[model samples]
Target: MTVEGFDGRLDRYLSEVLSKTRSFVQKIIEEGNVWVNQTQVLKPAYKVRSGDIIRIVIPEPKQLSLVAQDIDIEVVYEDEHLAVINKPRGMVVHPGAGNFENTLVNALLHKFSGKLSSINGVIRPGIVHRLDKDTSGLLIVAKTDEAHIKLSEALKSHQIKRIYYAICEGVLKEDSGVVDAPIGRHPVNRLKMAVIPNGKQAVTYFEVLERYDKYTFVKLRLKTGRTHQIRVHMSYIGYPLLGDSTYGRSKNEFGIQGQVLHAGEIKFVHPITSDVLHFSTELPEYFLEILNILRSRNSKYHV
Candidate 1:
């Protein structure tokens, strides 16, 4: 690809233009897969000038060492190019570090077998985006590399719509508002994310759906998919999610394991057919039960 008006670091420019992550681009650059002005460039920090010609060679997918397990998964929709799954709470999206079994990837591997895309390598087979382990909702898996690239590009350009439902701890005064905050890894606690000045751009638009004395049910739409964007932003505004142990109160009356957040809906255009597709899933049974209890309590207070 030829550089246009960008005059920044090579890696950042390529990551923005190609819709690939910075880390992925850096890996290929280190492997000598990138060229600038017809010269092989190995450093990710190389500065680029306008009109400079650049080329990136994507390598073939490598063999991954993972076992397929017969785990149960809920498939919302599936076709030749992609599959949408309604992931349940408590299931990790993929294996990592200490978690090697009983993940959604294992279930996909068992069900699709050799039919998943390999762009994400062994561990994440067909994963295009991710949801936190405890946040249940819709997730898309690519059946082929072509679809994966298209979907990834769509996500980078904000063409894909992801809506979430969350039960926050406090009643928000506004009916609807946008949380425009940048998110980065927490400086003090490496395991957490926070709204820092130099963090990646993140925006979340939320609307109040129901309001109780001490809790508020809201719908959130993600404009940018930064890590833990909603959780961090909500906490920053003093309405942390009810059961979020990381960002909210440690003890919860609901007796839930994780945050009360759900990926409720996803909308995107079909990669090959160009047809618009939308999918949504209902809240989990436990979430609804808590809402009912809250409603009963609110009614008693009114009476």
Candidate 2:
């Protein structure tokens, strides 16, 4: 297909045509998928002249048994700049570790018809932020470079607000408090994050929304985005999230998969228009069920 754009640079044009990152687009060009005026263009920095015919032959991305399953996703907002999706429990955000296929990325590829921002590369197209495989709720995606840059800046500056709902294993003695600590990979166990003296600074504010005899439902706001910040902080303070296997509590009576946490809400300014954008997703059924059980048990015990 021939696209006509005036005075646009070659890299930008290729990125748009391939719906991928500059790196991926360059890789495609290197692999000989882009043709300019019937000749293959090798250089990403090649400037284009007016009335130039740019032909982009996008090869099918290497198949990896990653079928684009039509998994149902709740979309809160979508535009040219970004999109908000309500991810469900038991869904892996991206392919990693032993999960090579059947991930949110695979579903997105099938749903979006491979038209995703490639800034994060092929395996993680359009991914701006991420959630744990079992931690359900809202996530954001960037559709373009402008959107990606803006969102990344917002995240780095802590302007983008992310609020989560977590049911912890024990009742907090205080009504609310802050967990200000430094987080880093455990010196001995690389798989786990720890609050160490020389670690990166991390902060979290929490308020107890409901208190059960054996659990506490709290709303947590992250001041910094670190891997497992919420989980690590809560565990550090002596109340690990319910069903969290890695931290303090190793068992759950509720029989829930993974942790009982949700990325319930997100707020940020639009990258292109500077409009304030807010999105929220309700707790999944499993979460509500646990809450109901706790509430029911608490009521009877209190009486």
Candidate 3:
């Protein structure tokens, strides 16, 4: 990519282009992965000029000798090439800050160790996509490098379809709508995401499924996936997800843990065989419980 528009420090410029955090870009630059005009620059604050050719190297993640625990997980579909797993709430997708064990990666390692793909490194072998630790849903895992690459490209191109079900804090005035917004780190709260002008493109289409006295159940389709996208957008539009402590109300009104969101459906073409594959999952017990309570209250229903 050619540098244009704005000129600033090398790391700052790359962070905007890649839609990544400055610290993350700085780490890569420090590791000698970025070159300006074919000359490597180790300092993050190195000045960059407009029209200067910039090349970046995104090396594959290195394995960190992840552990394989005897944790149990549900595999919805599996072939020699890939597998789809239903991740339960509260389980981290992989190793991350302050979490190293008892994650979905550890469980996958226990069951399919040698057979999983290494594109995401040993820390997250076989993992292709992610669901937040509090979000219960379906995820894909690649078994080979080829499958990993193809699936990743498919996700990047938005060829894969992902659908989610969530319960938010109020009735949606419109029957359906779309939230097209740009999301970036919050200016005041660094730990949270906000709709910023310079943030990456994000879109979400939502249809009202049911409406209760104080809450609404909706089906959401992701047009472009970004970190905390659905949660951030919904909150931005004044319909924050119930139990969403990060973006919504922190009060435990419904006695539920974490946000009441779930990835209920996914569809995509098979990477190797070119076959179209679709998968759906039942909403977890927590979601069902709330819906049931709402149903008993004589709430309005829609398709």
Candidate 4:
């Protein structure tokens, strides 16, 4: 499709259209993989007008094997078409490079007995979306082709609302607001995501649920789910999540192992029956402990 009056910069446009994460898209641009109207445009922040046909070429990540390694998974909801699980912190959803063992897929294989859909190939049998290794939360897995297609459609249409709760490192100035910045890999640091010119369209909505002496409890709604979207957006606005070393903060006070965030809730329609399905999980023990510590410093806080 041709470009429109979308005021976002070039990277944002390409990212939104390609549906890939900002970091992946940015790599493509930097490698001379993006062209607007057949002309290569490498600037990440170049603005564009309507009807400007843009092309982005994204290279596939190195292929990895899906090996079964007997990791335990907390199953929350399961049906013929999908399975929702409380993916605990430290569990990798699928097997990838450098991590072929001790992943959720291996556990799924042991539990489901090869029943998950093979559409995602042997490596990621039923994965649609993904959570970072450190982010614990609810995740949905598809079992059949029909179910997978339906769930995919729902996610793309934004009908599947994924909400997260996080404890950011600082107090937020606004009670509620949207982070509508384009995000991509850091130009200098390939490991981190940043608000760069040739970044992808990323939007995150957050509301302050409570405030502490040095932290804020925030509820986040993702308009788009990119790799590290919430973390990057929060860091871009100067309120990185506690223990999220990749984004901005160098450390966490609560002694947590990873980022202090959780996929608190998810709402979607049943792929088979079309019934509305909603599931929520309480914060993990460590998450609550951190919040308690922060709130304890401020006696006005409530659980």
Please give the TM-score that candidate 1 achieves against the real structure.
Answer: 0.87
lDDT at residue 234 of model 2 (Cα atoms): 97
> On residues 10-96, what C-alpha lDDT tens digit does candidate 3 reach at each position?
998987777554656788899999999999989999999889999999777675577788898999999999999999999999998
Flag the better candidate by TM-score, 1 or 3: 1
Query: Which is the leading candidate under TM-score?
Result: 1
In order, what lDDT does every prediction score?
A: 0.91, 0.82, 0.88, 0.82
Would you list the rank order by lDDT, best first?
Answer: 1, 3, 2, 4
Give the CA lDDT, 0 to 100, for residue 106 in model 4: 82
Q: List runs of model 1 lying over 4 Å from the truth.
A: 1-25, 33-40, 45-60, 300-303
The per-residue C-alpha lDDT of model 3 at residue 134 equals 95
Model 3 CA deviation exceeding 4 Å by range: 1-30, 33-64, 299-303
Error of 1 at 246 (Å): 0.4
Per-residue error (Å), model 4, residue 123: 1.2
Q: What TM-score number comes out for model 4?
A: 0.77
Worst 10 residues of 1 by lDDT: 294-303
Q: Across residues 1-303, which tens digit of lDDT does each residue of candidate 1 receive?
A: 788888999999987887666767898899999999899999999999999999899887777677789988999999999999999999999999988889999899898886888767778989999999989999999999789878888999999999999999988999999999899999999999999999999999999988898999999999999998899999999999989999999999878878999999999999888999999999999889998998988875321
lDDT minimum window of 10 residues, candidate 2? 58-67
Candidate 4: tens digits of C-alpha lDDT, residues 112-200 = 77677654656888787889999999999888856866677677778899999999888897999999999888899897788888888
Q: Write down the TM-score for model 2.
A: 0.77
lDDT of candidate 2 over 91-204, digit per residue (tens): 988888677677888888777766667566667877888998889889988777668866876887899999999999877889889999999999999999999999999999
| Better-scoring candidate (TM-score), 2 or 3 | 3
